[model samples]
Target chain A: MKPETKTTSFDLAFYDRMAAVLNAWKHLGEIPLDKIPPHGMMEEITRLLYLESRLIDQRRLREWLDLFAADGAYWIPADVDYRDPRRTIAWEFNDRRRLEERVERLETGQAYSQIPPTRTVHLLSNIEGMLADDGLLHVLCNFHIPAQRGQDHQARSGWCGYIFRKENKHWKIVLKRVNLFDADQPQSNLSFTL
Target chain B: MTTYSDHLPSLDHQPYQHLFKPGFVHRRLYIDEDIFQQELLYLYGRTWLYIAHESEIANPNDFITRRVGGRPLIISRHATGSIHAFFNRCTHRGAIVCREPRGNTKGFICGYHAWTFNITGECTSVPLRQGYGKSFNLAQASLQPVARLESYRGFIFASYSKDVPSLTEHLGAAARLIDQWLDRGEKEPVVVQNGAMPFLVNANWKTIYDNAGDGYHPPFSHESMLKVFSNRYGDVDMNYYGSDFDKSPMYSKNLGNGHTFLDQRPEMHKLSAWKRQHVMPGYEVMENALIEKYGEAHALPMLDASTGSGMNLNIFPNLLIIGNQIQMPEPLAANKTLLTWFATSREGVPEEINAIRMRMQEDFPSFGEVDDSANFEACQEGMASIPEMAWIDIRRHQDTKVGALDPADQLWREPMSSDLHMRTYWQRWQELMNAGATRALVEAGVA
Candidate 1:
């Protein structure tokens, strides 16, 4: 596919729109207590998360990138309560184009940091789901990932909040935010997708 | 308190003088525990060390706690708009006073003993005054301030020694360079956006410092970034260091003291071409406005230069001003270092420009920094294996007759790949370490 040369202006109004979208995700209001998704829908959400985790573990970055909507964003904030990506530093904030570039870099064997590719296994549990007012499924889960490079091993635990939209019987990720417990701590090289 | 030199292994003139030659530095300088301790003392203790940017603590009673030169410090801005740096430890029992990394508070109260102090380091109250004797002095119980504090363009620096040279004198020509860069924006101050992005590497602190001013490693070490740039910008020369080094208008400058920077002004223009091709959302509008305001000839170059393609400045010991980030390395141990990168933006610049700065910052830490870290760890591991090969050569440009007197002389110009900057860095290190030994002997009256 040919890459799009057109670029969107990141002006004040663009930031305002992003802020509203992020705020809406933050204050989803606990599934309304009575509006929780049925057990089958919860199971389906869990199955989708498991499939996504497997794709990341398998290092199928191109396939994983295809699972996201065109306007989807993958955000890993330095702060758990982070709202604005423009004003502060974040661990990972990638639009679709950035994500594609990242995959391209990884595919090139010249990416020195990933020359000896890191192997990761993601363990996810406590899956919860609700149908939000915007007709999107809000799924939350806790994950513990054990990644290894040569003899070095590291365990990272985080809470993943995802917004998935149903399109033609398939679920597409609209947003994914992972809040790690030690997000602010000094980390080693995080070259691969979390 | 005992002097820093007294506790370390003797660094007297004997074997110390042989450790470093003109272009070769001993490997032990990086791995020796005794030398590391001495550096924490004579070098870091006596120098003007960068602590925090003033913008981090802009409001009254705003404070950020940081470890500067292996000591915990609380840098606070008082209600009067004055900044103060104090030891984070309490006077009562030496427990940490503030636990939060950053916050705004009128005063700090010790959780252990309830010893309260205001933002100015004045002890405001102490629990149970009657328990102490009648001569108990509240005045003596105040938080201990650092010996001296000074700021240049909102970059705060503190020194443990009051008698050291003034901060401006210490900075010298480097200060002028920094001022020129900061003043390039509109008259408004440069703001450091967000807190730091901290990373830990299994390498000595000096390893990180050495890499900051290094130009030779980029072409080889960051092959991936080069490939990406090559593919994106079809005109980009992939041979960054081969034949391009001869044509590239880039050189390394030792800007007095131990500070040095790489002048890559011409190469920056080449990289800025990518911006024009894949322009940001409102680049055309901004470009047209700039052209109308300043005329086409001037505005075009101005826009190109605004991408920060001039220099990569490294102030010795800690601070590194590269691209749009201020990176500082804190030494934790002989083989452990904490690296923090802070994104900086001009306060009065267009929001889109700042957004572009943020996008540029993503190129590092993820790819470029990870590549450097791999080399740092590999260098440390290599030194461990070959302890007998004590000297590492930094003699690339040593024979060049580039005396420090003339700034305009072509003799002073060396390719960006030269090791002149590292040689100058080690020369300063040897001088300061030798000065410590000389001072010790003079105090003992043996000289």
Candidate 2:
């Protein structure tokens, strides 16, 4: 039988509606480093970073979501050099809405990859922070997470870069990008937040 | 009674052939080292293994290093505009000539001895050549190329044996479906995007291949993903496979020469692909731009192109095209497999459309593949641990005579959730494996 290519006017409306809802993903590393944050400001930013890691480890996802600004994003690039989300694929690229969906899925207890749940201990180090001219604080830190699931224990080592913005007397993450050392290599199933 | 063992002492085809029954296969096929080695020689060595896409090395002198069938290869586009595949090993002292994974370069210089070879695998320069005898010829020192290389519709494939059937003959009826997929490009070239999402699964390559066309697993395996799709977006196009998915009209076909596909077009045609998707980052503005430029009629199909072609096409041994992604499962070992999903985009489409395509492509590998990998690992563990359960029963729909054959193409259509696809491939596998190493894959006029 011959394959047919049929077109309909109603099908056209779907594209229009979908395009209207789709947003362009931004590269988190686009901020320019102009100056260093004050010593106290760095300490405060470090405290917030520590709190974020702790929240994830404790499985307090809802609380962790609160640490992000309304327009925050969580990104894990497929490669360290891949800065353009438009052309490159990412392991995880979540906007606030997507992040909320991810949290909801995990909480449903049906996300089979995390059925028994992955127990993780994130160790953060080499923390440094700088302030952009626009009052955005960019922080860079090395991280090593020892995650265990069932009979398997995997040690994931990576460095994280974060952009923080202060809103109404609170520090919130605008973007968090994780760059694994073996970013381009074939990775095992990474279902949990890194 | 034949026994399946982890430490099988022989590689003889006679004893292993006894392990495959009519409706079941021995579990040792997934865990035994000797059988795995034999498979490498008999199946992968004889089949047309996918190597690289034409878009990957679109420009001359561009190259990528890949390990197909456990053999390290350098697929490069020569200055002469012809593509070439050669062993990645150096002619001198056996060191890897090119260390980098992929890049465009004039020539590759071996770090050990500074011996250089051009992109086309020609030995251009050799340091301290005078010290060697004049009998040592530069022409003879060129890298070794594979026995055969061929591509169809921008998909490149290579084989270490020249005795196999022609690529067109091997593709058989599957070519029509691949063309059906390519037609979405609207005559524009379908470009494989740069970044690849490759994940390691602790399972046999065939374990993943078996699941590729099995419509029975998705509702259970990807229940979470389906649930999220339903809760967030009402009635997504591809997410309709719920408890009653078996009753759906989708058909799984066994294309000849071990090729198979799970056709989701029946459901996909019910709705435009774009209308069924979860909302993306910047929808409104892009929608208006697309509608204004292409007009409503043209924009709809373009949106459909952004999602999958609604067909999960699996070419024998490797190569799977599902959604907007191209997957190739490279078997590292009997129990270790590395699956790489290459996201694809249309050449002439708008950046926003391709960008949205990229995001939608990540949905499966990140969410759905996680569960699939977990199951693969679990299946491997179970097979390795349970020696008593010697056979894996693949007998579903065995008695159902509800199949139609397209005599022109020799295509066989079966129920979506039937085991016919697996059985057909296994029957082909037994034919190849039992044929031993010396016989031609297709004799005289049989192909």
Candidate 3:
């Protein structure tokens, strides 16, 4: 006889929520017409995105940390389209505390993975932003980041989704999710943020 | 300090036998194409390769596609509640049948020709019947099964060799170690959850295995992480590898047949493993909730289980169990290896318990593993770029021995940093290669 379906605290609703964001990101044009942000807001959102990449590339990591809200999360799922952080093992799922530790680790100079240090250039496109049902600004874009560490070079291309909340008159990332095209495939050291 | 054995390719008729000796492994073992092929056949092909956790396919019709010894395989649970492993290759034209990584299905239909096979691997339907004469036997066209499939606890293993030892025999006393790991489930099932963090290293698979039980590298290889833990969390016992580390009660033991494990229980049991970990997002809330639900007495132990198993168990050739995670390294080529880590959860735990487990599980793979891959790749590069460095030294604490109290037959206990595990496993590897030499010679018509 088949075993009874086991139940745990893992909420399927989280998967449903993340899946909705992914579906919406994939078909941005199908988003409700009223949800689209104003053109100026879109331009501002794009500029914020560019600045985020610039801060990371310039190694202004402390400044980059300031771009997130106090409860911010940085997630890189092992699978691209579907993820339940509570159930699946993600490549990265960092709350603010973990992100702080990550930055501290990288700055320690002894993080051998980044000892020679990784040089990265991010090219972002297909930018879109909307005021979602959750009253948060949901921004989506595609990115191609070429990173080199010593002689090893990698081209990391992926789609990024950001759930932004206005905090203290500035846009702060509540959630920054990176979905790499080869998320399901094996990866070398991804010691840097995308 | 170059020994004559370092430069010698072989001591006798066996081509690769001389490459290994007590306390040393020749660098050629890592980079030689000829040696890699033989290793795939003699070592990986013949041994019990871990394919899946039975928890993954707990129900009938559940299947997941995986690679065993670099060959594609599908491990499925049939309707009779029995598990069977089949080569994913179709009987017609040799195309892979299943494309998805995992799913529960009534049956698998090859997208190539719509050839269908049941969950038990029977050839159920071929598009048009009577296309050929009676020469096309229906039973003959069924999926090819692996020679042997067996499981202990919830771990499933498959071997291609018909004459290999039983899985129980292969595991030896190491089976008891596995039991210790499984006991954490507390009568509830321990499941290998859906997602995994798979990282590839440009290094020989042996390099990865050598480092598994070597407690010497963490202080240097992961210096930053340890520093962060101390600075941020003030947990000096997080790693137990700091000052007086050698004095710490932790030890690495070599279980016979290349199986080995690092016992950190002595050190970890001093305080709860959960209290030692760097605090994360839901730590306080989850800890309190677990305490409230299971009460302080029962909840503390469960929290420790969630924090970590505190044991790093390495089953020879492929499987490495660290804490609650199962690590399987798939050797793709001489220098390309993919290591996949599956985080696990217990069947009866609260959602908060598993949630905390997931968050804590992200610690090593996300941070520490990157440094490991870096070293592995660097080791590969150095070995390949400079052939003159013929010996990959594993001589540290090599002279350490088993005490009178210890079981002398297969068990060897040493300080945490001893290279005894490497020495033990390489001995088994050499024995396999030597035995396989006759088969290799016969296959090549050299005999």
Candidate 4:
């Protein structure tokens, strides 16, 4: 969908500064290259990303809930790499109850777009380091999403931001953020999770 | 699959294409090189082809590379805050200067000769200033700007020829649909909801357009989705396919102007009270945008109206405006018959809500194995007939003139049919196709 008119103008100056900061975040893979990401953290984060992709791709969906915090959320913006979720619309938004319902509905009954669950291989790369002020370690990564369900070869690039805190000696996801490169661009059907 | 290479290369045969009419379309329109070439000139040349939106290039030096027909185009924001789109080919050599989908670049430097141009498409530097001798002036060659570029509501459009009607005029009657979609209250601006889900379909591009505003496909075509929704909510959510099924319904409407829409949104939301809440936000800024643009009461009802999510409407040629769902719903876009969906949102609801919305959006039968089945079934079925079919029917609603279009009705002049909308599209197509080459759109009849 193309714009009908320019009704919303973002803070251009701030957007530029943010874009630069985001770009610098891309090169951050250089930092932890010498030392492998901590195994436990890596395992935990990898599981989150993997579990997220699995629900939508493999359709295991029912198990998706085990991962999220009660207040956890999911977002797919209308525009590519959309920075502020407040400004644009999202394709999906779910709290814990809603999220569970989605999986339950997909499993027990007929899901429209699920004639086949999406097949996806999310390449998580560009890991960056950020220790939050709130005693939480936030790991950032750029996700190269290449998916194929039917004829469409869905390839997307996104920046992932996750806030993790140690819970019971294991990394528990506090907040997981995904900013798609084309976040602000208009979209078609995204019947599955990203 | 054979359709990929089954093209007929000659444009000459297109003149009397109505003659050999063995089936649906004269192969030339689909497989002919001449028709493709003409499309670049007539259709894309003078039409307000969609480019990137303002949000995509929000800052100076920000750039995105997209394709217009087969030609590469560059969309960028200059320091002056003006957005510009031009052919991506560098003047030095016919090469795509920008390869990345998006970036922030000060200027374009051709890898071949290093001819540099700033945001204005001006030649700022060249690798060998002395190589051209005194005869080569840098000002003579710069990035060529599109003949006409304008954007309405952040959506950027460009045309190779300036003679076509103004963007508003070109949008003609269809602009109302855009307005209705965004008006919330009449003062609101519809912000980008979710990123686009661009997928490729094996079928022709027209299939998606033909199906988008269709009311006939849901019960059976999207049975899985309908069944799923029905199973969960105990109803298909469609007035037509729900508990009350109308096998043969009235369809095809002429919205007077070229613009039109199918009556599906009303039924989808009617499935349940929960679905109604799923339709609109508790109170949205989009409503405020509408109130600011139109009025408060207008914005409230329009945006708050309970409706099914998929209200896919298209602006002739390309550019389709689809549903703005509150949950994990995405919009389906057709790129020359290839189907991809974008998960859209109204902008910054809660992440938790967006996640559920994304799940609902992406975890559907459409994106799963069934999309291939759904689209392929349509394409294979539509094209199965002999190539010589006579005048494709657009007469679905011609019999009963009224609201709510039925996809079963595919004829022009039907009150419920958007096929009449097609009449405008065809008229525009014929005007361009008949003009032949070299006869550019001069803001009047072509050749």
Candidate 5:
């Protein structure tokens, strides 16, 4: 029997809509306490982000994948001003399906670039609530990850904007956008997750 | 203060000539800083380096900053739409004039002395004009322009030496290929995508250049991508390394003037057609839209030609138009190189067509580039560790081969895996380096 696989239809309209949604969330700023989720819910959301970072740092990619919604996307804009990924190049613009494939490839020992995978310490700070409407919560934070591969060490710092939604009573990532400080500058190997 | 020539290797033509054979290159060429410096002066200094695409500075008073041959330059367009390239340094204090990567302004004002220059690189005003005597000429005070600047089909290139061949002569047969790729049956001109993706690789710039037309490494270096492609498509046979892959028709060509390219139209067209028919998301919608707008005859051929034209065309020195990406490499040091990828799109093409192009860019940095980077870093590390092993082989199909030749263009085409393309690059490098060294010797009264 052939192995079962999951696929998402390539819909330009769907992608366009998602881009609009992401643009809105990316521009969202700190919201008033009344407009955001309850204080306890806000803390839980921050905890989930910390857990996600820990999972990635531990190289538990599968567990990290579990934190994202089925339709979630991870994007890193090539432009600091955030040009549409469909019209321009991006450091990464992976949909849920593509993300799964990336995780699967990393799991395979044959992925040459990751043979001696880099070890990373992800430090998350400046967490702030942006918006909570339409059953989605937008949050923003700053991250500094120091990664070491062989004898080389690189410090990657970026601002992350995430849109979270509740799925089965657990906060799941619906969208994640990272804007690297040096996105326009030349970069060395970013083989591991940021 | 040591001059640049003082740092050049003492060895002359004889030693440099011995460094390259028909199918071998000396390891010193990759690791030696002296050779690297010489290359910066001889090879890069004389070549018609790609500086920017005209579309990037289409509007009046628009400018973009870039580094050419280790020197920062600003490419600017004036109100009349005339484009000019100038040294980014100010004349007074030599401070960088254009600090931003890209912007639009009527004129540039040097932060140090408030020296102002118009978009055409004419010195418009000086903060202390009265302080200078008649000896100070404002006409000569403008930012120093590059020796020569030219454009072909909106692609801009600049050379440091006025004595160098005209841009047309320099491009030669490579010009035809670029025109074919850029035109692509589109009425409107091709423009660069909004932004460029820049990334660094820990390897010699030549290593990256050599890989541009390399066909042997993909099957091995990008094995994971092929695997992922298979997993995602559920039809492994359509992958680049599929069992049904026909190797005979696909070939690499050594276009003169240090340009080399891989021609895989038959294979690429077949893959593109297959994807459009079976795999590509929204393929049917795109096809319908194109057919309705352009009619069946025009739309079908355009689609086929677009798919077939995706190839690796490296215009020697720094520019590489590989598939949909216009890539350029800047050599920072002997072991450090920065590569920038600019996505190109036809101005009037369907949005879906450009969407697919953007998707193709993801295939690289995510999978192919990292793999290539590993190999590049490994090659550099290995060559540095062992000075005893001096030669790297490029002799795969050197001795025995039946290859096609295009006499009019002076191009020789051979199987994809052949070393013809790499051999062509080294030959051009040797010729240019020897010429530069000879010129230097004559100028120094040593010849």
Candidate 6:
């Protein structure tokens, strides 16, 4: 599905305030950490993406299961109004249990496609969004995962790989959608988690 | 007009005994430029190459632009509800007029001097009326068509040569290849829901084509896959990855036309019970439909979980299909070929069904086991650069019965089971290459 192509340019002051929150929120001196909410949240966001992207790109699969909460879900919608999960086709959807099972199978090394794991380097930028009605940060960010194995090099842009609501302080991935410009065409097999 | 011999070694001259004897194919078929060019004519050109589906370009002015066998062509839905395909290039300077891969255009406009054509390939607009003076005739300048364009249950294909047979006639034994997958949809237009094959390899294009038909490589190359499937299914022997399974390594190499269904045996379905327990509900309905059409016995056998069809299906030279309805598993290969996947359902099927299909695609096909295994083939960088030993052998099922269900049957399944398919492909290819430029494909299809 084509993602919301909003030109979300914020004011320079908005950038400054966010930067200040990010910087000041860090702790090094004193007895312990201070202003931990903002910095910790940023750290968590970066960590969450890096961690999830690692499992998917590395095909670490089993290790990947450790990251998701029991009730957590993975989604990649095929259409725009994907906000309502009931309406569209998502590339993947697994509750924690199913995800764990898949990972376990991957661990036993039954996965044929992963004899050589998928190598990936993700570039994340333009992070923005607000706290949703659910209290989880409604995070919106753009990431490009350029992956290669042996001689094949391909890129899966996250105009569609979405990271949805995260509840409480615990980072639970509510949704991850990937929309490729070439999504409507014929494809080879895609064994890894995007 | 380079005859196959004029170029280098000729197919007629090469002793074809290996093709008849050794079930294994020589690697030369993979790396040979001569074979690749010949296929562009003998196979890709003459065959009913899959071009586009009706769902993709539905309305007037709606068009899907793509390259067909080395030529720039556009498949468009005309205002009259008919679909047409024509060269996308302008007849004048030969510049491609339409830039977007797809769109609803108000008559395509060429940036080079603004030569314009309608969605029907009719020349619509040109610069100043006096530009070419009296010598020019606009009526004589309409866009040239592909000569023969036809659709089979919405599968659009075009042939450049006027002498070719009907699309159905060209399909021949090949029709079964399309039927295996298309039949799954119960005669509906097999909607390709945003599926894409995105990997590029350094090897010759035919290398990939022949590999698609090879049934032997999966166990040795994809033992990991077998291991993964075993783990997923709770089977511990891993013997399925070895030669212990009933069909052993040969069943996977058994699809006709150099296409094989590795797990097409009882051992394959015995392994799938675990998957049957895990799959979405829609699969049952789809499976039931297949059972009814193909018969309960044939259909049930396919569900053995071990019976997954090879969606990594080889559609002749350059196309592969994702086997069945759900289309999940893994990114078949991310780097070896350019992958694009469409999550298709009956155009009017419930939205939730589409969603489930989409989810499955992410977990498997577009990012599935097929892609990863294929990617490793590319990394064997060792496979390509070694001594002139470029010829990999497909002699595994050399005896026609080696690939056949019963050795008594005279008809061998060719490249998939016997070397007959490759030999046929190569020999027919030789005929076209020997004919040279007048053969249309070698002359016109080549840039």
- What is the TM-score of model 5 when looking only at chain B? 0.90
Query: Which of 1 and 4 is the better model by TM-score?
Result: 1
User: Between the candidate structures 3 and 6, which one is better when assessed by DockQ?
Assistant: 3
lDDT of 3 at B97: 96
* All-Cα superposition RMSD per candidate: 4.4, 7.2, 6.2, 9.8, 4.5, 10.4
Going through the candidates in order, their DockQ values are 0.44, 0.35, 0.40, 0.14, 0.50, 0.17
Q: Predictions ranked by TM-score, top down?
A: 3, 5, 2, 1, 6, 4
RMSD of 3: 6.2
User: What are the models' TM-scores?
Assistant: 0.89, 0.89, 0.92, 0.64, 0.91, 0.70
DockQ order of candidates, best first? 5, 1, 3, 2, 6, 4
Better of 2 and 6 by DockQ: 2
Considering only chain B, report the TM-score of each candidate against the true chain B: 0.87, 0.91, 0.93, 0.73, 0.90, 0.72
Using TM-score as the measure, which candidate wins?
3
**Which candidate tops DockQ?**
5
Looking at model 2, residue A22 earns an lDDT score of: 27
lDDT of 5 by residue, A100-180 (tens): 878877776767888799899999998877555678887888999999988789899989988888889998988888888
For candidate 4, write residues B1-447 as lDDT tens digits.
222012222233235336232223343343334555666666666556766567768778888877765567888998889998888888887777767777898888877877888866788988868878989888878888999998876677788766556777666545655666555422433344345445444444444445554544555555554444444444333424653333323333443324445545444444342333321121132434446765755434544432224455556566656555311111122223333354444343333333233434544423232443355444534553446633444444334444343355432333322344444445445555554343443323442
Ten consecutive residues with minimal summed lDDT in candidate 3 chain A?
A1-10
Compose the digit string of candidate 1's lDDT tens values, residues B1-447: 233334344435532677878778888888887888878876777777899999999899999999988999999999889999999999999999999999999889999989999987889899999899799899899999999999998999999767567788878778877876676535457787564578888888988888888877787887776666557644443334545563477778787668888876566546453343333233454566666777877666555544653568888888888866788899988888999988776676655456555555655666578878877877877775696788887877567654343446323456677787787677667666776666567667776
Off by over 4 Å in 1: A1-3, A6-14, A25-29, A33-35, A38-41, B1-15, B236-243, B270-306, B400-406, B409-411, B440-447
Candidate 2 per-residue C-alpha lDDT over B1-447 given as tens digits, one digit per residue, 9 for 90 to 100: 221121132343354576788789899999998888878887887778899999999998999999998889999998788999999999999998888888998888889999899998899889999988888899888988888899999999998876577788778778988898888746567888558999899999989989988878887887787787677776776567864665787888888778898988888666666766655543444555688888989887777677767889999889998877899999999999999999887887887687777777777787789989988898999999999899987887777777777565667877788887799888777766765432432333232
Docking class for model 1 is acceptable
lDDT of each: 0.75, 0.79, 0.81, 0.52, 0.78, 0.50
Clashes of 4: 130
Candidate 5 per-residue lDDT over residues B1-447, each given as its tens digit: 322244344546543887887689998889899989988988888778999999999899899999977879999998888999989999888899879988999989999888999887789899768789868889988999999999998989998876677788878888888987876665457788557778788889999988998877776787777777676665432255454232646778988878898876556566444243222333455556678888987777666544425578999989999766888999989998988888776677677667655655665777678878888998999887897898988886787765678666657887788778789988888877887787778678886
Q: How accurate is candidate 6 locally (lDDT)?
A: 0.50
Put down candidate 4 lDDT per residue, A18-51, tens digits, no spaces: 3454455445554554334566666667776666
